[model samples]
Target chain A: MDDRLVTAGLHEPGLAVHVEDLTVSYHSKPVLWDIDFDIPPGVMAAIVGPNGAGKSTLIKSILDLVRPTAGHVTIHGLPYRDQRRKVGYVPQRSSVDWDFPTTALDVVTMGLYGQLGWLRRPGRKDKDRARAALARVGMEDYADRQISQLSGGQQQRVFIARALVQEADVYFLDEPMAGVDATTERTIVKILHGLRDAGKTVIVVHHDLQTVRTYFDWLVMLNVRVIAQGPVAETYTAENLRRAYGGQIALLDSAATLTPVD
Target chain B: MLDILSDFTLQNVMIGATLLGIISGVLGTFAVLRKQSLLGDTLSHAALPGICIGFLVAGTRSLPFILTGALLAGAAAALVVVFLTRTTRLKTDASLGIALSVFFALGIVLLTMIQNQGNAAQGGLDSFLFGQAAAILRSDLYVMGAITLTAVALVTGLWKEFKLISFDPSYARTLGLPVLALEVLLTTMIALAVVVGLQMVGVILMAAMIIAPAVAARQWTNKLGVMAALSALFGVVSGLVGSVISASATGLSTGPLIVLAASVIVVTSLVFAPETGLLPTALRVRRDKFSLKSRLVLGTIYRLAAEHGDPAYPAEQAMIDAFHRTDTSAVLSRLEQRGLVRSTAHHPEPTPHWVLTPKGLEQAQTPLDQSGETQ
Candidate 1:
């Protein structure tokens, strides 16, 4: 990874994702306001907040899926558009129609579409790579299964496999664990951990507060604005949770029991 | 059949209808999967205004001019729908409905004005309302053929891109696939299909031509490529058969007949297609119930034998029925057929009794945790 970064001849040791003064609104109603944060390379980070905290909006704005009213986002010291091939995104599972007539393998192959560019279909090698990714997520037997027929956990794995095939340096996942089973949740966390160990950064919009301390090493607590952002040990405190979740301090109090103070 | 084939008018009408079917079938798959079936209806109705504009401009009933106008009108209608949905709080259905009614009313006003002018060239212009297959000329076939071939080529070349957009547009955009441009291009292709079909199925029935074949094809396959191909085949069959039937009949219109043929295919596919169809699913449910009942009956007999401390203890039929609160006679017979149980007469008892066989006893000893399986 270091060699590739050096070969690209860009700046040295830049943040995996950097956002400055980002604001987003729908019809003049602000969802996120003047947000600023940076996620360094090779860490599994969680974006934790209550519902309607603009967690999804933050990810979308960073990935350039949604236009920001102010500020900009960069990946590896470059604008999102210029570094798109180096980034992979896993949107919420509910974002797609499960009943679409396609196999699991075909869905995973979509991750390669950006790199493949326009008008080039997935070939045998691309399919083999997709199959390998599916195997990594323990979905090799379900490669030919229709997506609609898969269980929710299996479907989540398929989405992860699709992201895995992207081979991107940074991965953004939106609510990957929502509504999935316990086994799938563990599998997804392990896979994200594996990527972080391999020197790839993973930023997830996570909802499970109880598992944050156990699952992630870095944390960004947000509530339409950045409450705190840093390593979990430094930031996952009772005070930060209260500030981020305002009026839901009771829920945070229970979750804070799992937090270990340094 | 030979005489029908030899007739040039019939031949031209059939060929034109076939071409129309192929294009609609191919393009409708995307529209239907995307849940934009109403978009086809709106576009077809909007084409009426285009037809009127074309007739007004050309001052003659030229197929190319009229179709080109229809295509443009349809595209405009699609844009209107998009604009309404994007700019205002109005939902997609409301936007489509508004576009359909407004554009169609405009078309009717233009059609009436043209009629009031007493132009002889406008003699057959009203045929676009409900298509007249017999009016198709060889030259019109050339135009339809070109449009059909072009649509097929575009779909073939951009199959993956189109499929991605149809299933998940946001994800497609994140992949940097130019989702907006692909959507516009796809909508234009559907409009082109509606235009090609306007003369044969008319504006009103053209939506059916697009939707019915694709809906039927979806029931038969779980792959998009197969569904599209099968949809095209179904469309072609409907076209050919409808044209022939209408040609043979005195008062039958080709448009309605084609729609009817396509509807028949849809109904058949919905009821009879394997795996996903209603009939097979219902049958499977019934078979599963019977197996479950049989297993329960066998288990009852085995439990009765075990409780009595006799491997061949005969459980009375009345006792089993009382325990289950339903007639176990039918289930007992099925179990007997499977050699899991046997009906016997216990000594000093007037009523018949049932006993489990060795195999049935063994089956009952296993846990009942498995679904849809007895042992």
Candidate 2:
């Protein structure tokens, strides 16, 4: 496998996520086509795109949640399956049934299931780690609260805490800011910044383009294909936004006013 | 009751029913949580054809052969639902409904064919439709017992994995768990649950055995472990009570009786369970309204006293009522009982008036912002 990755020139040591010729289709309807991008290690990145631009599909394809039709994704020079332990994921809040019978702490403890392996229950120490993760996300007080009883922002915080418990090297979050309160958005951004400062990769599927420049230093502008990818200062220009949003004049009019960082 | 317990046939019926209850209750928790409650109905109905096929193949109503056939048919029905939902535009309920009626029709056709075979040994074959608890044999207990043990053990060992998948399958896959395999295993477990109850509960009523206990249990707790345990307990109780009632009566079908018992538990839980019950919720709402009204009345009285520059000023009941646009007599009486207010006859008027006691003044003086902290 190492030889195959090396032969294909897919092994890039400094890139956190390496996608080469990735394409995905759902029943012959292409969602992502010939998408290629690389996010450098230790940078807080944003995958910005319009609705149906396959921002989620890109993240899911990289995580191997959705099988790509062609091409591959390597995380830190290894395939996702091999590097599963090093990756953390926060799927969309709508992806799960919130009314499920469980506590906040129990949901956070699920992150340890991957490490605990099969047929092994979570122990006291695992719960303590889960508690600590909850504390990091400011949800320690809600540890014993039922998930359905929490507010949208609190639920989003719980999800982040779950990923935090994974202690992974690369974190992929899908629209972590969608429908969340301002305070939760700040908390999530600060947490991502902390992860990046510790030399871990944090990639978020962000919707609010206004905060894209302020929150993320690395940007991958995608509309079914890679429009631009690099430092936010270089790639978050009005031209790239226009190309990505394409003919959605209402959104582009606002995008046209954003002054890209020098 | 003691005589019923001592009866040999009754003993076997009770034991078999109890075993069936335990497995169905445990596995049904997962089925209901996964929103596959109707899948139980589908699989149980689909098992009918398998029982008939087993009778034809063995030329006798052998319990093991019939149960094995039922298990296969139930599993096939599940696959059909999965295939239809995945390949076609049919939704899960639509596919489940289609599989259920189609397989049940085939089962009915086969059952009629078996009746026409003119075999004397097929006397009790029709009992699989609406179960006869008296037909439970001592040897059948071993089969039900084994299935119960296996299902319980699997649930205990794979508790977290099963929970994670039921709550979120995509997330489970991201964690490297064998999500698809676990799903298949869970579906098979539900099939086993249906198979175990085929003799005492029959195919038609077995779906209730799998769903009713779980539904009742959910109303009692928000924790999965507690819910599953309570569900199993409810199932066992319904089984024992249904079997006993049927054994004591003439021509009472144990299957329908057991289903009725489970339905009773469901209704009881929905109305009377402490946390999620309708009665408690309604009572709580009433309590909240009472407190809120009391606070408003106290605040109004306090304001009236302050405006009059007399701390002991009494507000007339009619005046207070006119301000709030509702009669405050009940609220004022409760407040008076709690020593927060007292009724006194005002001077120069025969009308009774309410005055806040010192305790009431202290409580009323507490800022509105602080009062909302209780909830």
lDDT of the candidates, in the order given: 0.91, 0.91
The residue ranges of model 1 lying beyond 4 angstroms of the native Cα positions read: A1-13, A258-262, B369-375
**DockQ, cand. 1:** 0.78
Per-residue lDDT tens digits for candidate 1, residues B35-89, read 9999999999999999999988998998888999999999999889999998999
| TM-score, prediction 1 | 0.96
Q: Which candidate is the best by TM-score?
A: 2
Model 2, position B286, has a per-residue lDDT of 90
- What lDDT tens digits, residue by residue, belong to model 1 across residues A1-262? 5565557555323799888899999889999999989999999999999899999999998888898999888788777777878888899999889999999999999988888867789999999999999999999999999999999999999999998999999999999999999999889988999999999999999998888888998999999999999999888999999999889899789879855554
User: Individual DockQ of the candidates?
Assistant: 0.78, 0.86
- Lowest-sum lDDT 10-residue window in model 2 chain B: B366-375
Clash number for each model = 0, 0
